[model samples]
Target: MKQPLLDMRGIVKSFSGVRALNGVSIQLEKGEVLSVCGENGSGKSTLMKVLSGVWPFASYEGEIFFEGSQVKASSIRDTEVLGIVIIHQELALVKELSVLENIFLGNELGSFARLDDEAMYRRTSELLARVKLDVLPDTLVRDLGVGQQQLVEIAKALNKNVKLLILDEPTSSLTSTEIEILLNIVSELKAQGIACIYISHKLDEVLSLSDWVAVIRDGEHIATKAAADLTQNDIIGMMVGRQLDELFPREVHDIGEVILRVSHATAMQAGASRPQVDDVSFKLHQGEILGIAGLIGSGRTELMQCLYGCYDGQYSVNIELEGKEKAIRSQRTALQAGIAMVPEDRKRHGIVPIMSVGRNITLSVLDNYKALFGAIDEDKESQDIDDYIARLKVKTASADLAIKNLSGGNQQKAIIAKCLLTHPKILILDEPTRGIDVGAKYEIYKLMFALVKEGVSIIMVSSELPEVIGISDRVLVMHEGKLKGDFGYRGLTQEIIMNCAIKEGA
Candidate 1:
């Protein structure tokens, strides 16, 4: 038999005393694409970490073979030297650095004694062109949008002479158009004989890109089959160990009188020509799921930030809570006034990754757990934390485990739990299920219904149009920071929403 380009055997990784990967094994050939799919916390990313040296050799029991030779890599650099590269789910680019600087941050060109700026600039330009990213090499990463930043990361990867590549949820923060560009880039790379292990919750992309699909459940390899023979339902069934009939489980809930009204909200950045949020006005009712839909940069997030009192720029808003005009100047004020928000970038703004899961959940409501002379009431706090953890069905080894160790879906649930502890009358969810699996997204959708059934109004800002149409009682479309169309969800479709969002006067 011909030797495969890469082979991993008997990969077993444990955290503390619990096994995350149970003797998982797989093989990949050159010029082939293998997509790994699973539910959240199903050990998909863990398996990739083992192969990419993120978990390092000797830390786990596994045999890795590259080009028919056994390999033991101690660090990511070691794997990179052997033509293996990985782009993590969470971005690793330094915000302070420019695109050219980030692409060649450590891997510079020229002699040992001196660096080559001209050579580096030329190579960066070539990489940027290869990735179809129309951006200046000297452009700062901080100034770019999330999708642009994602492309920049891809550009960085293409700069390396890689034989095997790994992408973990690369399209999680991208727009649909940008997603297509990325998919095309991946196809181009496959044509160049680069083997790729694609890990994502998006099964459609998996089917479209992969020559084979590998499904894992609870850290165990389930099955590997030709992508041409497998359907999305087949993959989902393998990942979750059951058939999920409905991806979007929307329930009927009563939408009552307007509990909150936001009028003429406008947010302006320091150097921008126009406001981020332009004269946005809307009303959210009791027990209502009001979804805000737009392209990523259409100011949906900015409007929500303005309402939550977290917008970085100058903004003015007139809010009426329960028929009384109110002022929300900060997050504390928003929370105190019966409003809570689960921000867009969960890793950056929602959770403190270093903190324990239990602690992170109760962070916003710490004052509620205070006892005696400025010390936390451990007993009461743990009880509340446990309750929320159970309520949200967050899968973790222990509440005391660092939240960073949990899956992306679980981390999002913890952030939602933190917001819920505020007991807010209205909840703001921005990109609530950005990188979550289909199963987890269903759970969150069900939870949204449950919350609204309990009289908690919700305003969901999402880039996904199907989600906006499915779970929303009403939909508000935004374009260029302005409200373009507000409609009942009864007859709403993605086309109608997109038309309104893209065509200014539609």
Candidate 2:
């Protein structure tokens, strides 16, 4: 048999005495693509870290072999010398730097005495062309969209002459078209004899891009099989240890009378020719899961921000609650008016990472726990925090652990818990499940159902059509800051939503 291009045997990794990877192993041939699928904390990222030398050689018990030779990588740089590269989920580009500058930031060409700008530019152009990104070499990274930046990351990897590229949740934030472009780029890379270890929660993308699929559950490698032989159901079963019979657990409930209405909501930024949200007016009823569906730049998030009193630019709106006109000018005012929002970018806007999970959950209601002389009622606060953590099923080693220590899905649930603590009549979830795994997504969907059944209105802005259609009672489609269509869930379809989003409602 031909020797495999890469082999990993008996990989065992632990974190703080807890095993995160237990004797997991995988093998790949030249020009092949392997996808690792698992839940958020199922050791997928841990294993990848070990392979890329982020955990270093002595940190884990593993034997790695590449090109029929034993490998020992003490650092990421050591592995990079042998053509191993990893692109993390959170992009590592300097926003202020130009494309060419970022690509050669650490690994500049030419002699140590001086840099070679001309050579770097030419190489950057070639790398950009290879990745199919149509941008000038001098364009600033900040001006590029998320999709463009992702392509730039790949170009950086190519510049390293990467033989085995490991992508961790690469398409988690990309639009459908962007995702298609990236998948095509991966196909091209494979044709050039570059092997890849792709990790993501998106099962369809895995099945389409990979030759083999590896499933891990709670730090244990379950199985590996040819992608052609495994369906999405099979992968989900292995990842979660059971068949997730329904991807979306839709619930039936009655939508009450309109509790809130907005008229002529418009938000505009400085020097921008157009409003981000242009005269979009809508009504949200009690116990209703009103979904806002649109493409990435369709102003779904902007509209929600307007309602939540957090839009950064100038805004004008007429909001009514229970037939009474109200003014909501800030997040504090919005919360006081019985409206709460869980933002799109959670790491930046939702939680204080250094704060404990219990404290983060109680952040919105800190005043509610105030005692005499402005002292915090620690006993009451602790009880309430415990209750919310249990109620939300936020899996944490302990409530005292920093919120950053939890996985993306658990952090999201904690954010939701914080919102629920406000006892808001309306809740806004902007891309709440953006990078979360399937198991967590299902749990969040179930929680949404439970919330709506209790008369807490919800406005969910999502880029995913299936999620919007499956969990929403009513769908509102937006396009270019305009409300294009409104349809009842009884007969809603993704095709109808997209048609309205691309043009006008038909």
Candidate 3:
């Protein structure tokens, strides 16, 4: 039998005396794609970190054998020198740098004396061609879209002469077209005898692309099976330790009077030829979960930003809030009118990472805790923060800890708690469950139902079609800055939503 390309045995890791990976083992055959999947805190990333030398040889208990040799790597560069490259969930490229500069940032293409620009550009051009990215070598990273940035990341990895590539949630921010391109690249890499370790919460992608599927739960390896023999439900069962009969836990809520109405809303960029959102009109009902579904750049986010008064572009929105027409000129105006929005980019726009968990949750509604002489009431603030921490089930060692210290799901919950503390009549969530695990997603879904039951309206904008079809009471589809279709979720399917989103005309 041929030796496995990578073998990690008896791997164990911990943080603060708590075990993150307990006796976990994984193997990858030469040129094979092994997918590691689990819930948010299930230790998948920890295992990869151990292999990539992020935890180092002494920090974790494990025996890593690469290419029939026991390897002890003390740093990320150590593993990279051994042909192991890791692309983290967050892209590592510098946005201000050009493509060629970012790709060769650490590994320069010249001797210690001088930099070789021409040689680096030629090599970068070849890498970009291999990855099918059609952009100039001098293009700034910031100018490229998220999908393009991901391709750039891959190109950078290819320059490292990688024998095994580890991708963590690589497609979480990519669109359908970009995902297809990335999967094709993986296949090509496999054909060239390069091994890959793919980690993602998207099960369909896992089952479709993997040769072997490994499930880890609670720091333990649940099972590893051939992809052909396992079904999506089987994988989900192993990840959560229970059969998820229905991915969406639908609950019927009483739909009441119209709580919000936007008529002839339009948002225009300063130098663009056309408006980002063009003459869109929609009505949101009380106790309703209204889902906005569309492809990327279809103006769904722009419409929401305009409604929330956060769009920098020229825009006009005539809104009726609780049967009274109001003009919202800024985010403060929108908040004063009882409208709250959870932005799409959580790290950039949602939470204050350096702030404490409690502070982030109560940031939007601090005025509620103010007492005599404009002094804040510590007792009331603590009470409200504790209430939300328990109510939303945000996992943290303490409320005083920095919000960024928590996992993605817990951080998301904290952001939601922040939005809820404002007591808004209308809550707008842009991709509420994006980048979170399935377990956390279910919890968020249940929370949505509870909120709607209490008469709070929700407007969710999501790129995931299944999520839009699953949890939404009604869905509005947009294509090319136009509302193409609006339908109830009773008989809706993903195909219907996509058809509307891709249709040529209004």
Candidate 4:
């Protein structure tokens, strides 16, 4: 039999006396696609870092055998030289640099004496073509969308002569079309005898793209089986160590009166030919969960931004809040008028990475804890923080820890706590569970139900069709900045929502 391309045995890694990976073992055959599935903080990314030499050889105790030889890599460069490349969850490309420059940034394509621009451009073109991307090499990285940027990251990996490609959450930000394209590229790479290790929280993608499925839970390997023999529930059961009876734990709540009404709302980008959000109108009720569904650039986010008073474009919004007309011009105005939003890109817009957990939670209502002498009341702040932490079940060692140290779900909880502190009548969440694990997603869904029961209205914008149909009281589909259809969840299906989103009309 042919030797396996990679073999890792008894890998043990720890941080500050906490074991991240314990007695984990995995093997990969030539050209095989192995998927790593687990919940948040399950040590999936840590194992990949160990394999790719990000944790280095001396930092962890493990034996990695590649091509019948034991390998000890001290750095990422060493692993890359051995044809083991990792594209991280957070992209590593410099946005200011051109595609050609970002691809060959550290690993330039020329001799020591002279630079070879022509050779690098040619190689970049070929790599882009291999990934089926048609963008020019000179295009700036910042100019591309998240899905396009992901394709560029893959093209960059291909330029490294990658024999073993490791992708961590590559499709987290991609649309359906982009995900299909990326999966096709992975298949092509497999056909060319390139091994891949795909780490993702999206179980459906893992089941579809992998030849071998490996489940890890709490830093331990639970099971590794053939993809054909396993189902999505089987994988989820292994990852969370229990059967998830349902993906959406929806609870019934009594939806009250119409609290918010917007009529003829239009938003236009500066110097643009046409309005991005054109004559959009919607109504949101008290104690209701209203879901907004659309494609990537369907103006769903733009409309939300305009409503939240953060849109940079010129917008005219005629809104009635509880039967009273109001003019909201800025985020401060929106917040003061009982509105709060949790943005889509959590890492970039949600939390202050350097701030402590307690600080992030109480950031919105700091004035409420101020004393007459102008001194901030630490005891009150701490009490409120502790209360919410327990209420939301945020997993953390202490409130003093940096918010960034928490997982995606925990960070989201912190942001939600911040919004709730403002005593907002209306809550807006954009892609609230974008990068969260399955377990965390359930918690958030339950939290939404609890909020609505307390008479708080919610407007959620999400790309996941199942989620939109599962928990939403009603769904509004947008197609090219226009309201295509409004659906009730009773008889709603993904097919109907998608048809409304893609159907052509003025």
* Tens digits of per-residue lDDT for model 3, 177-242: 999999999999999999999999898899899999999998999999999999888998899899
Off by over 4 Å in 4: none
Per-residue accuracy of model 1 over 348-453 as CA lDDT, tens digit each: 7999989999999999889987899999999999999999998888889999999999987789889988998888899999999887888888888998899999
Better of 3 and 4 by lDDT: 3
Those runs of model 3 whose alpha carbons end farther than 4 Å from true positions after fitting are: 371-379
| lDDT tens digits, residue span 230-345, model 4 | 99999888988788899898898999999999888889988887787889999999999999999998999989988888888789888899999988888789998999999887
User: What are the models' TM-scores?
Assistant: 0.98, 0.96, 0.95, 0.95
Per-prediction count of colliding residue pairs? Answer: 0, 0, 0, 0
Q: Give the alpha-carbon lDDT of every model.
A: 0.91, 0.90, 0.90, 0.89
Residue 322's lDDT within candidate 3 is 93
Residue ranges of candidate 2 with Cα displaced over 4 Å: 504-506
Question: Total clashes, candidate 3?
Answer: 0
What is the model-wide C-alpha lDDT for candidate 4?
Answer: 0.89
| Candidate 2 similarity to native, TM-score | 0.96
Ranking by TM-score: 1, 2, 4, 3
Clashing pairs in 3: none
Q: By summed lDDT, which 10 consecutive residues of candidate 4 come out lowest?
A: 404-413
User: Model 1, which residues run further than 4 Å from truth?
Assistant: none
